[model samples]
Target: MELLSALFLVILTFLVVTAFYHKHLMAEIPPGFIQRKKLCFYHYLLNFGFVLAKTSEKLGLASEIHVIRTIMNTVPPLKDKHLFIKDVRFEKIKVRIYQPKIPTTGQRRGVLYFHGGVGQFGSIRAYERTCCYYARKSDSVIVSVGYRLAPEYPYPTQFEDCLAATIHFMRTAEDYGVDPTRVITCGDSSGGTLAAAVAQAMVNRKDLPKLRAQILIYPFLQAVDFNLPSYQQNKTFPILTREQILLLGLKYLNKDVTLLNVLFEGAHIPEDFQLKYQKWLSPDNIPEEFKPRGYKPGKIIHPLSDELHALTMPTFDPVFSPLIAEDTVIAQLPEAFILTCEFDVLRDDGLLYKKRLEDHGIRVTWCHLEQGFHGIVFLAPLGRIVSFQSGNKGIKQIIDFLKSI
Candidate 1:
């Protein structure tokens, strides 16, 4: 009886400490945020889980990512009478394919989806409902790539896996009753980064069937400048923050997290490279309307150390920063559907990429959610408690675009 009481006291102490720390770090929900009350509850629950994961990691019971992935993957797969879902491998990479049950006159469009989690925690299992919804609504086959994540697979592996799976799917698309020529690449957040990179990489390939379109849902496209107007406006917004992005990015790249502050200050980019890319990356390219929240131009506060530049140089590559791709490559790419959220730090990344595509005469469809936040689309299908109307609107916009094409 005494031991049981002692254990209960320890659990209570941990819970109290976790709650206090979460409150300390939690950002205030903007008054205009969609479903502010629901957002608050969801954020707190998420933060509490994160605190538990961190504590578990410190106790050597499990890795933080393992705990988080377990929690996220615990959502039971959605059973839909209108969809047929199966697990398969494309070039040995795990993937879940979702197809409509209803018959069609001809082959349907194919979408290769890569889920977000900054290339760290997301899984095909976690995004089952999302893929099922897309397949049923768009009346298209959806392929959710389960690319190998970081701290195990490391940099370039995620991109390599995504590209490999896409190529394999393009080759075998006919087997699944999908039209190869009409295949699309779509993803959100880091997955958005992969989709953009895959699309850019495929632009010059002559053997593969050309992609019909690419959809990037609030993607992070550049590392050179994190001080864009959206970043300044939404740095403290929940679901995702500027600091979280950089830390996750470093973890994805297997870089030292201590360099995050320097990267945030814009010291990782060399002066010459900055000048060369300024035309495409400069905030001036963003329309004035986006600046109503207020934005000030930022200058590099410190010189780029050679060590820092060498360590962080991969971030500036066009493969990583699709916004920095060459005009020739951009011109040949397929039509694009880019979505941005008003409260997302990466909103300007989508906006800037849209401008680059337009400048190169590529057709682009852009959607901006004034009240939406990052990860809204994925959260929408989770259940009513965390669902937001803006998320449903965003998903509808995507489906409408898919059907139109």
Candidate 2:
């Protein structure tokens, strides 16, 4: 037994050392105010994930990835210092509600927050701290939607769950002392995708209370062109790599993983359809400043595959890619607050969407975190060792915008 234990320790040590070397050497981190502390934390997280996956295999788990995800998803204990927190159901979907304990003269502002995990991970319990912070600091009644994830639930289910919960909350906001008219839809990463889609979906609902604003923090707004400058620049950035981004989409859509390479090369989009989306998603829309980083316009792969396009059809819909929505729909969108990070592949998504919203004559408050990377918002409040200054500043910017509106 002692010999077996030593063998395990040696394997673990080897894995950590190799993973650290890959992260430090192979990772394509962009030039900016990169924080060593945050980088090291991310490096360790990847190493731990690798170790857990191997350990799960030894335990005869069904999936090594699933085992790793399950362990990481163990929710922390609730912190309800300045708020009354409750876990409730909105129709069929589950949601966590946070209402301030302090007395209010009138109905408080409402924020419907969706957490990010590329569609397969993250939950209200996982995002308890972030939601709690927003509710307490903003003094707004916040509902963190625990939408159903993918691989088990399938595509559009996440969107369906978010839309249902938002509708339920909007209809019953008064009962929770929330002013329906002042409500905002907010999210990060893929959650930002849902938040944008939900906000756009709400704009056409005559019966629902109009959302005052929509906040998208480094959202994955389109699938048409993954070869954007940001993708080229930060393809291997920690937390969310370019290949991982497409892999998560395939998982969420219930498609075969082998399709990842095809999708990555832009072969899943036809020539005509690609042209239709190009007007909105083109790199030409990106600002001149963002182009200084290593960015070469990639050639659209020839001989678009019909089967591949058919497999990825839903991704082309405005529901999935809100950035490609028509001008008419965009013009009707509520005021927007967009945050973009320097070292994030999804940076151009936020930048392009910002330009689209402003072009449509919609009010926009933009926050660019020059020193930040993807997943920084969640890292900020996790203590000095794991947190980034940009994450704290980004959250402050969101709160300030919420206050202004």
Candidate 3:
């Protein structure tokens, strides 16, 4: 046993060392001229590889997470640059504060950034590059929240952690040289879900200031109808598969997997509920411009048994579907900036939310990445060889919006 344990430790150390070497070498390569398209694929695999590496102990896969952890954190916090980063604790939650290092004549906006990882993976380390970029480019004090993951703490824990952190920051913005009046919540994927949810929840709270805006980057707003156009079009597409998506949802909810088919076919939703959300959740709501890539509306099917529907009803819970928030709640929410990727499965989710926000007369700044795919933003410029123009363009749009508000 002792010899076997020692062998495992040696293998782990070797993997970490080799990964750091690759990342170090990749960083030295010049951007733009590097084989960016190929590097895009590399980062795509690396993102999942990080998960495999950390879970290799339980699933015996491999450990790329250690490699990313080493390199992503290699650029020590640039305390001398545009942002002043300091670790602070509020409401029992830990956060990294990114205040602009340069003096501002008046208070600046604050961005409450939540990192994406499907609620099971990812951390501040994985998002270190993104948060750092925002802090520097937008000249806004950014607070990146490291929320808890799932299959560990179960549902609501991640949401609660983010809510507490965001509210605390809003109430105490003056302390960080930020104007509470202009605070906004921003996130991607699962993080986007949190951003939207928090915005909706705090819209009418007279006790605290209203959110100036919400920036959702292809957020996963609902598990209710997984049959949206983007889901069907990108179901088998690389990065996030349809079946793999269902698996992720189940894992996130800590629910039973025995009746997975019922959830996928839209069975958990009742007839009335489907009819109500259909106005917003259906493919008909998708603009024709998006259909140039080919999207056929899904055929409506009959409802399932009450037992089956009851089992999967949590998908419609406001915690999971912020789109279902009361219209009164929606109307009170602040302005928003939404970005949708053409090849992402969650594209329809963002489109639907945009219409809802707009229908309620809220201002929304929308940006679309015509050729970008799911998780493409994280790969924009992670290393020297793989930054694509589309990814960079999309990222610039985000920074530009932040600067605008």
Give lDDT per model, in order: 0.89, 0.85, 0.77
Tens-place lDDT per residue, model 1, 1-405, is 999999999999988976675565444666566477667667777877888999999999999999999999988888889988888888689998898989999999999999998888999999998998889989999999999988788888889999999999999999999999999999999999999999999988889889999999999899889899999988877778889899888888888999898888898888898888999998999999999886888887657678888999889887778889878888899999999999899999999999999988889999888888899989877777667989988999999999987
For candidate 3, which ten residues in a row score worst on lDDT?
28-37
Specify the highest-lDDT model's number: 1
Per-residue lDDT over 1-405 for candidate 2, one digit per residue giving the tens place of the 0 to 100 score: 999999999999988987777667444554445575557567566657857877878888756557655755674656777899998899988898999999999999999999998788777777888888888888899999989887678878889999999999989999999999988999999999999999888888999878999999999999889999999988877777898889778878778889888777888888888888888888999998999888998888877767777888988888789999888789999999999998899999999999899988999999999888888888665567667888989999998987787
| lDDT over C-alpha atoms for residue 61 of model 1 | 100
True-structure RMSD, every candidate: 2.3, 2.4, 6.6
User: What is the Cα-based TM-score of model 2?
Assistant: 0.93
Q: Clashing residue pairs, candidate 2?
A: none
Colliding residue pairs in candidate 3: 53-62, 53-63
lDDT of 1 at 125: 90
Worst 10 residues of 1 by lDDT: 25-34
Model 3 agreement with the true structure over 246-327: per-residue lDDT tens digits = 8777878877876678766766777888788777776777787766554656554575787766677778888778988778
Q: Rank the candidates by TM-score, best first.
A: 1, 2, 3
Q: How many clashing residue pairs, candidate 1?
A: 0
Clashes of 2: 0
What is the model-wide C-alpha lDDT for candidate 3?
Answer: 0.77
Worst 10 residues of 2 by lDDT: 25-34
